[model samples]
Target: MRHTWRWFGPVDRVSVQDAAQAGALGIVSALHHIPTGDVWPVEEIAKRQAEIAAGGLHWDVVESIPVSESIKTQTGAWREHVANWQETLRRLSAVGIKTVCYNFMPVLDWTRTDLRWTARHGAKAMRFDRIDFVAFDIHLLERPAAPADYDPETRDRALQRFRAMSDERKLSLSRNVGAGLPGSADGYSLPQLRAHLETYAGIDRDRLKRHLFDFLSEVTPVAEEVGINICAHPDDPPWALLGLPRVLSTADDYADMLAAVDRPANGMTFCTGSLGALAANDLPAMVRQFGPRIHFVHLRNVRREEDRTPCSFYEDEHLEGDTDMVAVIAGLVAEEKRRKTEGRPDHQIPMRPDHGQEILDDLTRGAQPGYPAIGRLKGLAELRGIERALSHLTYGLS
Candidate 1:
């Protein structure tokens, strides 16, 4: 794996020099200054690439050029937005950036009810608690038909939890869920968020999937022409939220997506934590099945919901969660070798340790999700050690 860090432009708390110290040789970043639906100028892309290279790292992948909701729904301005995205890809490829990662999760990118969940080890981990989400959807944001979204038992428990919350607790829960999580644009107020959710109300799962296909069908050919691979990220948690549908959450979703576009330029970013959230998604099997199309990766693990809550989980140690980390990495290594032997471009699959827990050094720092230095440094070290051992065992170190 070509270890990389997600840099949110110059304003990011973590600097390129800081990333260098973290032992990452690649920077997974974007021209975030250009808002969604705007074409990323080639000059701007060159400037960012120069900035990353100045720190002795290569701009390996564009973490995203966010897809606009209009494009996702094939509604107002969608054709224009799709054209802009194609232009962005063409510009990015001109600057030597080949891999671009984007997700189709409606409204929020990745939802976490608790920004800070205390672990048994006493470290802080980002979490998604179901009751908090339910309280937000039902009592706070007050989405229509939220009651029917949950089963009887869940609805009762959510009501009980909502009744017990003080005004402040209720407000905070609303903000936490409605406000976008880390790497998202920004959190929205109740009224603003509801308005956003309303946009997706008419765009159900099937419609969203069709929109995604249409967007891909338009962009993939441009990607192929420019030598850029567009990789779609899976839906975080692989479930519906606030009655808004999620389409890119499963293996079948990926199959349908690629088939729609039917181009190698259309690809995937195999985020283990996102897909692994679904208990049925076999991470290793997915790697084998989609290996050829996977151009980038995000490696992280999560403990599933406890019996106490329907959608509760905390970031687990790299080797500790539901995902079979070893087998997943091994499959990637096999693909790497196969690509090399076939005289392919040897796509340096850049990976970042997503959502690391706050550990000893940064316990009180209120570090952002998955961006703390200490925890992710440990994760990268562990993954690298495993990769080295596997490389020796599998290919005898050449």
Candidate 2:
């Protein structure tokens, strides 16, 4: 288990120096400045490489080379976008960045009703309230068929919430739910998003799966040739939202993904917080099941509500939430042992303490919502301790 930190390029308030200070050996980042579906030329990749190297950190993985909407829908310039994506993989591999993390979540990369929901301990944590989201989808976005997705009680509460909300609160809800790629701070207006939705008029889960497989068919070979592991990030919330299909939400989904294309290049990013959002995901068990194929990992926790399927949740401290993080770490340690025994080069998986609370001076640090310097440093310290204990207990050595 190699410690890594997600660094959003040089402009990020939490600098590469901060990650190193926090004992992270590598950086999980991307050329987020480049637009989606664009070719990340070797020059651009190298420029980012130089930046990380200067901070005494390795550019271990690309957290995403975003799979554009065009590629997902097989529409306008999709073929071109696939080619560009393939080229990006080759370039990244050539620059010694072999693991590439990307996601298939439609429209929004991740949705949260509040970025700073106050924790009981007085720190600010990212949160997703089902009620707030339902209010947004059914009342504000008015997504067709939204009522059918929820129970009548939920809809009633949503309706009441919407009716009682002021115009400012409604706009806030819209922006929060429709919020796009956070790294890029990009998003779409309601009408614009509605038009985007129309592009998928006839598409459903099976169709989306086929499209994803088609995408893999085009790029996996290129990735294999380039020695890149294509780690697909699971869908956040791990459920359908606003009538959009979330194909990468469960273990079965990943099983199907692997069966679609059985290649080492086709793998997954084990994200505990996202998978833990759903009650039935069995995160620690998933860690054991998908152990070999998980190329990168995001270690974070979420406190999910108990009473409902689509429940409210807020990010928790690394070890506090429902996820059995110690067991997951032990699973990872065992996998690392197997890989080393098998003579695999990437025996130590690159992992980062994912989303964290904003505490201490981080309250004024101007850091990105979940990437607070002090908070992540704390989580990383805790995770590092877990790894050490597991490594020592399993092998009697670090």
Candidate 3:
């Protein structure tokens, strides 16, 4: 596998040089300054490429070209947005960047309720407490249909938790849940969020899935023609959030998605932390099953606070979480060997240490939440060690 690091461009506190020092050969990044529905001009892509090249690294993957809400709902200039997305793919291919990772999560991207939960060793990690999220949904956002989404027991627990929070805590919780992450476009105010949610009034899971398929139908051909792989990132938390439907959460979801387009250009971004959040997913098994369709990988792990659905989880060390990191890497190694034997062009996959704990000087640096430098360096070293051992055992270190 090719080691990559995610860099959020010039505005990011963690510079591209930091990624190089961390031992990453490739960078996973995006033109985040570009608005959601606009086309990424060739000039902009070239400029960003030049920036990464100046750091002695090449941009291996585009973390995302944000799928606009209009595209997700198939309303309000969605057709034009699809045209813009196709153009972006063509331009990216023209620049020799083939892998494009994107997500179809509506209204918000990857979410967390607590950004600085202290771990056992006093390192700060990102966490998603179900109760806290529920409190935010019901008591803070006060969505009309929110109560019906939870059972009586959960509803009561959330209400009690909300009532116990101080005013400052409540404000903090709202900001954490409502705001977008680093690469996302912009955060939403309460009324703005509510207005956006109203747009999906009757679009249930089945309808949303159809929209995704429709999108693939239109763009996958362009991707195939241009030699680009468009991979959909699995939904973070791997579940429904804020009354929205999450179609890409399970192994079956990936199976269905790949089957929808049935093309090499339409693929999956295998994210262990996101898929592993749901206890039901068998990580290694999914890797083996979808090996051929996996275009990009995000290597991270999460510790589920409980064994139930909708339970809380926090980002854990790269190798210390519930996921069997060794077994997962073993599967990836085996896949690479098979690809090599078959003489496939895309034999070595591109992967990155997904998110890391805030340790050492990370706490004071105010680096992007979940993207501290030293912490990710630690993760990359550990993951690289595992991959090396697996390769040695599998191929006898030729």
Candidate 4:
């Protein structure tokens, strides 16, 4: 695997020089300055590329160019958005950047209820507190039919949790969930979020998924012709949130997506943290199964509580979480060898140790949530050690 780091371009707290010092062979980023649904002109792409090149790192993958909500529901300006998306692909491909990682999750991109939840180890980690989310859904944003999605006991618990919150705390919860993350298109206000979600009132899992397939139908051919791979990142937390439907949450979702599109450009990002959060997803098996079409990887681990479902998890140390990091890496290594044997140009896939815990001097550094420089450096070192040991013992990877 070619090690990479996620950089939020010029304004990122983690600098390009920091990525260089971390020994990342490639940098994963996007033109975040540009608004959603706008074409990424060649000039802007070249500028960002030059910045990365200055740090001796090449921009390997576009972490995203966010799929707009309008396109997801086939609502306003959908055709124009698709046209701009295709044109962005053409522009990106022209600049020699072929692999693009994107996600179709509506409303919030990778929802998290808490950004600084303290772990048992005294370090801080990003957490998705189930009750907090439910509280926000039912009590804060007050989604029309949100309470119906949860059972009586869960709903009661969420109500109690919401009641406990002061005005400031409630607003903080709303901001945490709605304020746009790195690749999220817009930071939604409460009224705007409530109104936007209403659009999906009748669009359940089946219809949302159909919309995803329709999206691929419009853009995959252009991607294939342009030598670009559109890797759809799995839904973070791998489940429903705010009463929204999540289609790309499991292994079956990937198989269904690939079968529906049947195009080489349509692919998977294979984020372990997102998929591994769900107990049902067998990490190693899923890695092997989806290996051929996987264009990128996000390596991170989450510690799920005894009662993990309905969402309760915190970011854990890379090798110490529920996921078997060694076994997962071994599978990825084998898959790379398989790709090489098949004579594929993208045999060596790019990976990044995502969402590291806030520990050591990281707390003082004021790093972005779950992206402490020291923490990720520790994760990358551990993953590299495993890759080296496997390659040395089995000759399966070099």
Candidate topping lDDT: 3
What overall lDDT goes with each candidate model? Answer: 0.81, 0.89, 0.92, 0.88
**Estimated TM-score for each candidate:** 0.95, 0.97, 0.98, 0.96
lDDT of model 2, residue 167: 95
Candidate 2 lDDT, tens digit per residue, 307-335? 56788999999999989998888889889
**Where does candidate 1 stray beyond 4 Å?**
307-310, 393-398
Would you give me the overall lDDT of model 1? 0.81
What is the C-alpha lDDT profile of model 4 across 64-174, one tens digit per residue? 988988899999998999999999999999888879999999877888888888887788888888888999988888777887889998899898998899999898889
RMSD of 2: 1.4
Cα TM-score of candidate 2: 0.97
- Order candidates by lDDT, high to low: 3, 2, 4, 1
Q: For every candidate structure, what is the RMSD over all alpha carbons to the true structure, in angstroms?
A: 2.0, 1.4, 1.3, 1.6
Question: How good is model 4 by TM-score?
Answer: 0.96
The sequence of per-residue lDDT tens digits that candidate 3 reaches over residues 1-398 is 99999999987789899999999999999998899989998999999999999999999999898888999999999999999999999999998998999998888788899988999789999999999899999988999999999999999999999999999989888888877756665888888889999999999999999999999999999999999898999998899999999999999999999998999889999999999999999999999999999999999999999989977999999999999998999899889989889998899999999999999999899988899999999999999998987788555342
lDDT of 1 by residue, 278-358 (tens): 887888999999988998999888998664324677788887888889899988888888778877784557788776878
